[model samples]
Target chain A: MNFVGRQAFRGPGLTFCRLLVARYSSKTGSKEYIDGLVKGKPVVVFMKGTPDQPRCGFSNAVVQILRFHGVENFDSVNVLEDEDVRQGIKEYTEWPTIPQIFMNGEFLGGCDIMMDMHKNGELIEELKKAGIRSALLEKAENKD
Target chain B: MGVPKEELEKKLRSELDPAHLEVDDQSDGCGAKYQVLIVSQKFDGVKPTIKRHRMVHGAIEEEMKSIHAIQLKTMTPEEWEKLKPS
Candidate 1:
């Protein structure tokens, strides 16, 4: 039984290891993943659908909020892009939801958490941490 | 919009292999809330913020969209007993 228990764990451990290796071996390697990701870039969102076509309200809300911030330097990836990365990211980031926000390579929590932080001014603080400062240019333009 | 509890329970147990599990259907009430209590070995080295919740969601990825808010109280059995020592 103990051996079975240990083997049960070893299975996933081995699986995770093989995934890591395969993740980096092909021409479509970690760099491609990184390139596809906005890790070192500005504000990047990995979402269910797209900013214009969010599959869920949660994704839409976050995208709308970012738009409100007048932060135009945003990039987005459709998590539905690759099924493996979509599922693997669930394991990789340990976040269950789409519309994951990353700022300069830092994980910035999920939609609800981000909404709370953005409501409380911490979103701007996090953005500052990533050297982002929102001028609300869109707000200004809309006003005019 | 709500899934049958028995089906959900069976699927969750089979998929996530939890050490503990609980489910409440509060869809008729405010927030469309469902309270889930689950403890899984998969969460042993995972972060507390969402480890158990995600495990459950992954197990029932299809249901999350329909169920509005799920109040999750995920813990190892050791922690579950401590928290619910009533």
Candidate 2:
């Protein structure tokens, strides 16, 4: 991850500089870059596209599931943009496949595990364990 | 070259010693993707689903490099028997 936050580019002339740095950093394989992104966010999804516009069905399913659980704010990295990061993440997690999910710097499995956890009510417990409160669970509790 | 379904079955059968195993090549003619169902004593104590997945992945780590995707359904013998229709 770039040490410079997006907020730092509020200056008039710095927007272009940020874009340049983004392009430059992605060319180099930086495990630190990946680590920084995962460590800083409570929930990190390394998927094919942004949460708003996922490039694949599996990625879209994960984004929708997170939304259904009322998790609105989370970090998403578009793996399609960077080849190094794409391959690097597979090696980093030792898991084959994209749309990987990490919570509190721990590897949770891909879409299949997410769906399984969601079905069994384990996902809500997982979110709470990571210090994220789920509105879905809250709604269920209120109905009781 | 992509991995063959028989190769994956042979690997999992030898490694996990599964009581039942079904390996389906879902990649059409390419043999690049697979859907596997395994029932074994090895999965009995594997707590989380992800760890169970890791055991399967580890069993076929070499073949996994050439394969595109693996959709796995792992169960202990008891769980497998419970899910059986008859």
Candidate 3:
């Protein structure tokens, strides 16, 4: 009897076992979990990597922009670790891209939108409306 | 597997009736990425950048599935006119 088939079977079986565990824990679904995460935070970014070591340029750009605006505290979810959460967030927000931003539980746009808003001074205004203060104004005032 | 730039342009044209539209295939022959600049009256009075993006994304939701990335710039006709050269 050949052991190759049994070895292959074992590999797949192990993977299946892990998948079952993931599914059970995520039973509430990624959408609900994502909603819960974004509900309380004034600013939440679902990005590809952690804030300090962003894996993607788009995600890095967002982090820098937020920092430039003086936003010191915000939640960041790294989607690279979980395939389900990565895909689930796209469906949850109806947005096809990563580095998505949510403000006050509302789906904000991606990096491009953030850059545009930042250029037009809309980002600062939106932060103010949400009761979050940015350091951009302080920098401008200090410069004057 | 990938959406053609022309197909995306057609969908946006029909839905938004943009006064000015430019769709560039940025995927370097893969046809998976695109950049669009659209100016339309429909965007008038649209507050916030996210809402405007959602309007554009809504118009091409089906095609979006096949697209890998979309860098979109949306503007009102008046804004477009201002940016236009004399």
For every prediction, compared with the true complex, DockQ reads 0.13, 0.70, 0.68
Q: Residue B73 in candidate 1 has what lDDT?
A: 58
Candidate whose TM-score is highest: 2
**A16-50 per-residue lDDT for model 1 (tens digits):** 44445444555322445544455566687877788
Q: What is the lDDT of residue B70 in candidate 2?
A: 76
**Candidate 2 stretches greater than 4 Å from native:** A1-22, A26-28
Encode model 3's per-residue lDDT on A40-143: one tens digit a residue: 56898999899889998889999999999888678777789778788888889888888899998888789999999899889998898778887988888899
TM-score of 1: 0.52
Better of 1 and 3 by TM-score: 3
Q: Least accurate stretch of 10 residues (summed lDDT) in model 1 chain A? A: A27-36
Model 1, span B1-86: residue lDDT tens: 56676766787789878888887877654324566777777666666344455667778887665655555655666766677759
- Is 2 or 3 the stronger prediction by TM-score? 2
Estimate how well candidate 3 is docked, as a DockQ score.
0.68
Number of the predicted model whose lDDT against the real structure is largest = 2
Q: Which consecutive 10 residues in model 3 chain A have the weakest lDDT in total?
A: A14-23
